[model samples]
Target chain A: MSRHARDDNVPLNADATSSRDLALEVENLRTVFHTEHEQIHAVDGISFNIRRGETVGLVGESGSGKSVTARSILGLIESPGEIDPASAIRFEGDNITEYTESEYESIRGDGIAMVFQDPLSTLNPVYTVGNQIKEALSLHQDLRGTAATERAIELLEEVGIPDAARRVTEYPHQFSGGMRQRAVIAMALACAPEVLICDEPTTALDVTIQAQIIDLLMDIQAERDLSILFITHDMGVIAEVADRVNVMYAGEIVESAPVEPLFAEPKHPYTRGLLRSIPSTQTSGDRLETIKGEVPTPNEPASSCRFAPRCPKSFEECSEVAPIPTAVGDDPDHDAACLLYPESMTTDEAVAHHRPADDGGEQ
Target chain B: MGRWEYFLKRVLLMVPIVFLGTTVTFLILRVGPIDPAAAIIGPSGDTEAYAAIRDSLGLDQPLWIQYAEFMRDLLTLQLGESWVVVRGQSVWELVGVYGPRTLWLGFWSILIPIFVGLPLGFYAGLNPNTLADYIASFGGIVWRAMPNFWLAVIFVSVLTQSDALFGFSWGDWLVETQIVTPPDLSGLWEPTQFLGALKAILPAALVLGSASMGNEMRIGRTAVLETKNANYVEMAKAKGVPGRLVVWKHMFRNALIPLVPVITGEAFLLLGGSVLVETVFAINGLGYLFFQATINGDVPLVGSLMFLFILLSVGINILQDFLYTVIDPRVGYDGGA
Candidate 1:
């Protein structure tokens, strides 16, 4: 591993600390798919960091590039889609965006692993669950033969699968959906990867099973102190699991804040709309507020704010210029890309400006 | 049903299929305009001799009695005697002489496709839509489009022509170099003789195999491409399994499941290809024997050969069904539905 000098041209934020606490840092990560006629900017210059043992949630609707962002971190994007040269992905201070395929192999399951959605599809139907986990152990660890099999059973037991010894021999179809997902998670944890990217891991399960999976993940995280990049479209799931939340829309993170503050005082109109759209127990028999207009295709150049067309609080300035990340409220850690959160404006003033005339000035 | 029971049921099912196929073929040949007696006696007036031959062979029996006799002969494995060609030879004796040669050719025909085509298809499928994929796919189509008879002719002319334009003597070299000894067609039952005969049939097998290889390659390539897109394949990669392991361990076995039926179908197709190839290469296989029997209007020989071909087709199908259960656990006969 050659320690190449970092390019000085790329801007670093306050969160870009040299602290050993930081597990992974993604800076200006841009994934573009070049088709015959146009380039689709899937993850356009998205940047965030995961501190060690912290669960950071990336919440977005389908096609918002959340999954692409996760795949990019693992160097999984192939031809037709490319991670741009300007992008930089660092794992524990080592820049890895330029890592070759072979180099990425060493880092992938050893340092960073991923659990994808659709567990039934994720597991090979022909193989026994234990064999799949054994494959992972043998690949990244020196364990093999009986040692590998015993470890695989232990991992299965750790994942809360019942009858671990007997059930390990069963095929994917033999297990229920939640158990399959747990098996997948056990495989991901085989090497005790530093960062585990869960891309909607619980999305395909029943509500009860979803809660069980979430609980299992939380328990595993607590025990292992694993840095988890939890990607989902469900805000409620994020609230339960994430310490920090990054709200993504139109291929970029629009706002990011500590989980509590982001839910209570979302700065971006998109994030606010998302929170409002959730059917709450307090708002029975009322129509849910939806963000108007469809998300624009990423192929179009975002000369102005990407969310301006759908944002309820868009002003004349919103269409004239794109918003850069600016510190919101008193917490400099909370940042949002919206004209409403201009560096000069206070949080109150920004909220007041966006509040419609008909709405009472309760703030 | 238990696995053995299910397997037994599948095997039992073949009996009816083979019986029906043989019956249909027998009726078609027996009721057809071609008279075996006339064919054997020829145009040189021999009415009395023809009548005597018809009576002696039981061709003068009623249609129903003839069918009953045929069925009885089939059940008893007494397939009767060759009438016109090799007049007194039993059909079974002829098969004994020629069966090994055909089986040897069939084995190579199938083996060549698997060994040569499978790897090529796997390679092409690994990088689909690339230049290599396009070339391999296009070449397969061209190979499949060429008729086996035409290919056989081309191969013979190219390998055996000793004079004139583009002269080459690969066939002569094969024999002279003793790389492939001339098969002692008479003693093919002996192991050494059979081994030598296999070498003699190599050219025919290559021609037969190439025709089916095109189809097998295409089937293999398609299966691989489909398996590549399977979610499990992607999951295997995400598990950080090495690229080679992911391909061979995860993808290859899954890909092969769909190719089982194609393989069995190709086995029967190879038999068809062998007929043309055997005639062209002058190999004394069942295919050449069938051709001779058909030309000589040897009813018993032709009937028995047709029965054998039908039996093989049904046997291969049953074997393929059993293989499906073995290769893929998702498919099972336990439900007894």
Candidate 2:
């Protein structure tokens, strides 16, 4: 980014986003799927901001709506799945929740592109890898014929694919798992998106390839100064990539913190459980520590803390009341949505504050 | 192996299967209770006449010699004269007259469904679980459930009667305006002749096409549904591909992978349906000829028609295999693996 958000220019904990130039700012995003049986709030009211040239992490386990949040940013959600109207997804400065389908067609790939998990299924098996990339090029950049073809080859080489000129003519099945992911990343970068939403882009690859892919992403981000919203379940990956992290559980962000402080002195009980579950922390023969219950999915309205069932520090108040995100330490940037903090919203107060989101898309 | 090489190999493979089929058919016909000699020379005829009829048919020769002669005649493509179907008429000459009629009906039957069912299924699949899908699905089921013979009877009855609508007899218009008698297939390219031949075959085609059309619709809906949500399709959308391109450019080819067998099988299915449909309409197509040949123990007529049907079915299957390799890169042309 030519213009970086100078956070130091403003006071540390200012309430609004006026001072820092946010590349993408989301507030009160509630996405749900109204099925025949019941309503599924895939991503409940959650908020975060990504500054230009920085990587922000959205970490959650499977079904915690990390991918849904990534898709909602691009307006990729179809019917039966809906983004609540009150949500504000401001890209750069414009509120994009109001963007029409045609407008989204223009904005996607050009303004913000995406790279998904599972490289095997991500690329079309029928077309040559070069042709798939060229399609995106022609759609957004008006590059066609030889120009598109040359650029596709150049992109493949740039992503470190050996014999790229020849490989570009090959299909997805011909490429190994790692090469396919590299090709996918090359396509996402084709239209030069300002914000890249990578939903577990490296998860499907082996460890060596996974590290290489992350390194490739960082190198590209530095070259172009791209802002990325990296969503993954891996905390180790989050620590490496993110400047700031938002930890989600059951369709809600339970904690938001600068990566170092959050990992060093975690506040939320759920975040603690995640940290402990990492196998590397344990002795070689010792059984790994894991949170007891399955990850909760808040299908109906929840008046109590969503993680209370699996929380090690659960008490009567935790089961009886919801908690609002509040500062856990003097850092001001570190906040966790747990009633353990003295200043946090508890019981009736937190419930009333979170009421507007509960009205959902039904009305 | 190269695609053409594979295709050639499949063609060569067909020879043995066909030979086996013809040999099996010959054995089945010969062992039957109805002896050709008795059928031709009735019970009233004397033993001298029965012996004369048998000699003429070459049935007096040993079974092995008769088989050898039959195989030789088959290899030379000389189907012998019909014993009873057209009395003493050659089988090839009979097929030339009747083959065109049934083939014409099959053409219309197959063509109508592709245009109708493919689009209908695409629409239903795109808007799955909606009212339009439900309506199309219901209609498809009702049409498919009706047997060809039953539906052909209804069509004949409906078109047979002249009804007055807006002072015009639509029933007569449908049945008689373009009814060609004894099929002048040579003039079929002329507009009037073309339409008349088409009209004569319309009832049979509609009945024959119905099941396959419904099948295409249902299978198409399923294929589309399966293809639409594929991760690759979602990747197209994320790449800013327009909706139409996402469906046609990305999803269509993948969806076609599953529908290939269904499309190829429609030919054999229509041929099967043609038997009942031709009998109902009394159209004198190959199906009617086959029916006559079977009952009269016209071995030459039955064998020739059976060869054509076997060739057609095998050819359709070969085409289907070739199509799969063209549509899907994952399926290699590895000499049928």
Taking all chains together, each candidate's TM-score versus the true structure is: 0.88, 0.92
DockQ of each: 0.45, 0.50
> What tens digits encode model 1's per-residue C-alpha lDDT throughout A116-168?
99997989977889899999999888789999999999999999998899988
lDDT digits (tens) for residues B1-337 of candidate 2 = 5546666777688888888887877787776666888776656889998899889889979998988888788768888888776788988899888888888888989888888988899889999999999999998898889988788888766655535324555436633453323344667768877776777777678789999889999999999999899998988888888888999999888888888898888878545667788777777788888888888877777877787787788778788878876888776433221
User: What are the runs in model 2 whose C-alpha is more than 4 Å off?
Assistant: A1-20, A342-363, B1-9, B162-168, B171-186, B333-337
For residues A152-203, write the lDDT of model 2, one tens digit per residue.
9999999999999899888888888999999999999897899999999989
Q: What DockQ would candidate 2 receive versus the native complex? A: 0.50
Backbone clashes in model 1, listed as residue pairs: none
By lDDT, the best candidate is 2
Alpha-carbon local distance difference test for all models: 0.81, 0.81
Candidate 2 residue-wise lDDT at B178: 34
Task: List the pairs of residues colliding in candidate 2.
Answer: none
TM-score, candidate 1, first chain: 0.90
CAPRI-style class, candidate 1 = acceptable
Which numbered prediction scores highest in TM-score against the true structure?
2
